[model samples]
Target: MTMASIAAPARTAAGELATFCGSLRWAELDEAVRQRTRELLLDLLGVTLGGSRVESSSAPRELAQGAGDGQATLIGTRQTSSADWAALANGTAAHALELDDVTTESSLHPGVAIIPAALGLAEELDASPAAMLEAIVAGYEVTMRVGNALNPASAYARGFHPTGVAGAFGAAMAAGRLLDLDDERLTHALGIAGTLASGSLEYLSNGAWTKRLNAGWAAHAGIVAARLAGAGFTGPSTVFEGRLGALHAYTDEPYVERLVEDLGRPLQVMRVSIKPYACCRYNHGLIDCMLSLRGSFGLDDVERIRLGVLSGGALLVADPIEQKRAPANVVDAQFSAPYASAVALVYGSGSLESYSTEKLADPRVRRLMSVTDCYRDASLDAVYPRQWPAAAEVVLRDGRRLSTRVEYALGEPENPVPLDALMSKFISLAGRDDAEALADRILHVDADPSVRALGTALRSGGGST
Candidate 1:
């Protein structure tokens, strides 16, 4: 399908995305894509419910509650807030746990930004389940496309978080779809959202809560942009590839063809990885390596641990080795390779609980981190952004060395976690067996008249803090 059939003064990038978003239909989506949407939504709802109770979500949740107009339900809570507020609150919560679905190639977590906006607006406008799913697909496509074009590793090195930057477009696509905006209005929404996009990688160094709020902020801004556009507001149609636009602003070189390549023929959402561990996607392979070797050696038998990770990833999670060894807080610990490897080696697992303050205070974990070393493997740099590969070696007290390497993390598309496994994760995170029943309903959501049933089910079962 051509990006734009509309007569244009110029066939701009924004016009292409607008055309795609405006014309996308559920009927054109493959069965696999539809089923994947259900799986992604189920996981997203579960993680949002789990994240809602985290300490980081407190201020936003309180703010949303204070600003409430009952337009939408805040995933875990029975309380309601305006669509934008709800999106902000829930989107923040969704990302707080670091369990959201992600496309590693784009370095964007699709569900956190898109799902909150789509679900919030779906509840507010009483949009159908089919529409919600279509919105979700469009959101993923646009977000990943923009992220892909940016060359995420280079963007990351430039101190930008791709998710926070690209997520605005994703949320806008979803919101525009739900609003049923035409090509022109959807183009305006993209332009507005592009200007609104912003996020900093500084949070990685400080363990600040701002990183958790980036996707949520983008989601909030996108909803507002879409609403404004629907009200006939005008925005720059050349907002993408223009000299002063998002593409040039975010990356040194933008591969703009990636923005519309293959369009909807092969859905981008299918490429996303559902995180198994609650940490940065860059650290997943390292953690997986540690998890794999946990039973082979004892933490007490270890004298030192060494990690070889991609140079780009080292910039995010493993550099400044001392800081990684002694993280200041849970968020810091979550992104620390030494800390993560230590947690896995000492405890035989890494979960949401593993990054808690109490766990951070564990003497064994601390001692392990102190002995752990993380360094860049220049040899593995070529495989990065496509596959997050890691190599690990443990030096034991008895003069024995055990080593392993993992090319794919447990939840990567190449090594996917099964749907049943995802459902089990959903049940655990949602904190109720009823999540299974909800998953059943979500699988057939296309047949539902409205998305309100999913919202209703979401509010109940699992997580109330």
Candidate 2:
């Protein structure tokens, strides 16, 4: 077949998305969608604070600190930097703990990439809080839509990190909106992002910190791409559906129509899940199952643990079974189903505290991990990318098998975390006495004239009530 015969309609997908991003207004958002956006922002901010001091964030934070001063606040710090640099530091920190908001169908952490880029540019431009929220909504919509189109399973099969690859486009849309780029320029921004979008699953090989860098780099590249677009730079308009476009290049299976399907009827922000656990989203359901079963049996009575994982996510959290059972660090533990199960069964919870160095060396946890076996279950994969169901079966020393299955993890929209619980989580992660007040400010940011005060309040070692 000729190129023309197989080529997608020129610019259709990118054009539609650019038009949506360029024209999306705060006034168009209903209170529910707006509230969801605010909640996601609060969650992102809390996670950023919680992860700012992590080893993975150290290099990026230092680079941002030394990149020269600008108007943007480096989140979780009493410092300022250029918009892109600030985005780099804040995005990396937001994802460091794996607690950022994630999507069901998209299978990517939208807020980590979108919120940091939007916040930094919004601060630099002195934009209204409403504008910032709108930019974030636009970013989430684009990111999730692109992720859905990429067929996350196929992307993972190719050893690509969907969060980093799809996140760049989302960040560009948010940044470009903040820069007041029109539809054409926003389209160019997406095209520019296409070249910059990248993330390798190779981080899984050795528990590398590069996985955390994916979010930061996506945010940085997005700001740079938008800035380049705003400076009259030109890029291909058919960046999504073209033969060599993102959808084709990133995955073997591309649901291209998903990009424009039901464009903003309900808004993608409403579909996001806040993570209660500090690990891969794939392990959350299994942890929930383990937590539910822990009280029913004594730890010493367990002979073996069998986990049901979705085929799509198996590569992420279950495969290389031996490696999953022996996590070397926090990053490894975060992606290991066996480790997640072991910790939840041993500690009866999967909080950030459960993934520490002490837990990594805990003999009880290691023993449980040794007995854990993760297998792909067709039942779990049947509704995956929509519902991340999981199951766990424990064999007792007396030959009794105790089994439990979870339809939705605690933080999923279907099994949503209560507002008070979310607040408690924010307080715990932010580690601040005034976290409640800061959360309130974040929730009602749309009423504020500018993001300056809100940005200041998000900084560490300062901005206390």
Candidate 3:
């Protein structure tokens, strides 16, 4: 399939987004959408709490604490700071563990950027849970729409991280909704957000900490953009379709019509996939297939393992086979399909613990990774971005071969992880004894008058306020 030529939209991208953000209300969402929104929010927050305990979080957490005190709450810690600072800290933490929810169509993590912006601003304004939910829904819609409009595979190939770039719009829309901005002001916010959106894919080349910080930076940029627009700052209205704008600068071809196509019939959040593994979303299907095959194949008896993946998916994690097999750190392992597959073979699982520093040196993991081969399959590539299909072939030392294919990962919309499973996953990551009760409160957050109560519950576990 080829990208279509960009055509003039009946309405400008910014104008359409402004109209949607200004008029959207949580009540307009169906019951399932509302409940899913709550689930995703809770999931992200749970992971954020878990992420705060990781070593990478120290810098961001310290930065937020140094920014001075305010109403915003940091997810894992008991600290408060200015809204933008809190977004930076909380967004960073949400993405640190690679456990955040993903919008498969756009290949972006909406909640990492949207939740921090919405929750931070909501706390500052003492916003109602209904209002917070509205911001999240609006944020997700705008982010995914813009993400789809940009030819995502081309963008990634051009060395752009979709989450960091698309996240700015998600953050801006959420903040704009919470600020109660009119269509005009919200349009300005989106325009400003488009210019501020930036993230490099260079981090994939190394186990650098930059990937963890991209979402936080986007969240911070969005809050500042929204605040500027609310203060009467004007930005170019045609930021998306402008000659020197995001689409022209970052993508090969822009599907401009997707920005507002089928505006609100099906809420995008309901289609998002909550990750079960602490690895890149691109590698999930292959990891699923590998884990399923683990029970039958012994590490010592396996000769070679092959993975057939979408060609575009290989660009991010599969190629550079040597680097993928010898990931320098946890961040590197999370994006490496080879490393992830090998871990699944040796350990029977690929949870967050599997990426620890000590695990990287496990001789068994390295031996298995060295023998794993990943290549593009025409069939898999054909259905990518819509269906993340993957196939696994295992060769035994005795010449016996076993193969299996998976079209959807466990957490994908087609085969969703149930709420009970989600809750247990959250508990495992959250590390709190009373997590179930806290989760109950968060799942029913729509009924709460303000987000302050939930914020208090999160902070009560640890950190300083």
Candidate 4:
């Protein structure tokens, strides 16, 4: 079939989005948005370096190592591979630590999927830093917009991971822009991406590694889609609003208008939240509540711990009470509200070390987890996907009830994590003595003539497991 035959009617959603992605320029971006993009890039790269040596990241890294040499860099290692393979390896590593940046309304990790693809492709094309940054912004716009329309709660219920699904579109846009595809080709890239989108929630059942792979695969598929489109491949233009489109296929109830609502007035990158704790974004507010009550009572003084949770996130963090209470491994613990709360109370912190195997087996943590109960709170859900508020009550052994609520968790846009704190996080993850210097380079990356030097620097710095 001809490209025109498969194209949607005039001014289709995909067409409009493609026009925006194609026309976006670095000079048109607000300074704040540009800075935020830089910060996010720094955050994602740090996380990738930290997670590069993880057991879950090993397979993809090995695969990339043997995928044949090219210009793209495999983050945290002195290796080069094809752009798609490098994106897969780096994306997997970014998500492995569960510390990647996440969006509020969309409820997905955008940086994990978009940054890797943008960075890899930019390096391969020898694209300027400004071009790459513009691509990154375009990618975030498409990913978050599609995610918003999916109604994250509904998508999660259907056992679909929004990041993997929406991320494919975002990656394609970023890659297509970097590849200098025209508006028509960019539309086809999105259409092709719609068919490639996929990510299942089955990993929740056994703490499997597929969760990390979702982000990797999304990035890989995006580059492939863009490349195919640039090579004159055609895809349906009604990829978003059609009867059999992504909205209908992946979600029970999708807010279709959200796909193009308020097109980039403020930019989606500003809405992204950097993760303070190394776990599910759903559990961050709960952890905040737990930490706030930590100094108030001794572990033994607590009779029962009741947590107010968002109904939408209940399945990922609260449901299957037994499993949540007794997380089998790091992956399970990362998604369990009970485990996150208990660990925060016992350890007085919820850092990556808090989720280690040793901490998972701690009798004190286990005892505390048994007493913690997560219940859906309408009050908390009212402003969800926008605020993510949480509440917790401690019923003491002496019948005293102490309660507290968190309107905004640290690292959120409203309650932003300080630059010093963000830098500390980056240093800890980058695991190199020159991490601060590297971060400086990343922040000013837009001035660089090309991303090739950045890749060389990343390889030289390396990263810790």
Q: Model 2, stretches more than 4 Å misplaced?
A: 1-11, 463-465
Q: Model 1: runs farther than 4 Å from truth?
A: 1-10, 461-465
Q: What is the overall TM-score of model 1 with all chains considered together?
A: 0.94
lDDT of 4 by residue, 1-465 (tens): 766566545587888899877888988878989889999999999999998978889899889989998888898888889999999999999999999999889999998889999999999999999999999999999999999999999999999999999999999999999999989889999999999999999999999999999999999999999999999888778899899999999999998998887888778898999998999988898889988888887888988889899988899999999999999999999999989989999998889889899999999899889998989888888998777999998899999999999999988999998878888899998988889999999989977889998998898876432
lDDT of 3 at 235: 73
Return whichever of 1 and 2 wins on lDDT.
2
Model 1, position 365, has a per-residue lDDT of 93
Give the range where candidate 2 is weakest over 10 consecutive residues by summed lDDT: 1-10
Candidate 4 lDDT (Cα, 0 to 1): 0.91
Task: Report, for all candidates in order, the number of backbone clashes.
Answer: 1, 0, 1, 0
Runs with alpha carbons beyond 4 Å of true place in candidate 3: 1-10
Task: Enumerate residue pairs that collide in model 4.
Answer: none
lDDT of 1 by residue, 1-465 (tens): 222443333478888888877777888877888888888988898899889888889899889888858668887887778889999999999999988988877878988999999999998999899898899999998999999888887887788888888999989989999999888888888888978898998987789999989989988988998998888776778777888888888988778888888887677888899998888877788888888888886778999999987876777788788898999998899889998898887776777877788889999999999999987786677776767788889999999998889888889888999988898888788876676787778778877888887777777663453
For lDDT, the strongest prediction is 4
Model 3 lDDT per residue over 30-132, tens place: 8888998999998999899898888788898789889988899877777788889999989998999999999777888888999999999999999999999
With candidate 1 superimposed using the best TM-score fit, by how many Å does residue 152's alpha carbon deviate from the native?
1.6
Kindly provide the TM-score of model 2 when superposed on the true structure, using C-alpha atoms: 0.96
Winning candidate number (TM-score): 4
Q: How close is candidate 4 to the true structure, as a TM-score?
A: 0.98
lDDT of model 3, residue 404: 91
TM-score per candidate, chains pooled: 0.94, 0.96, 0.96, 0.98
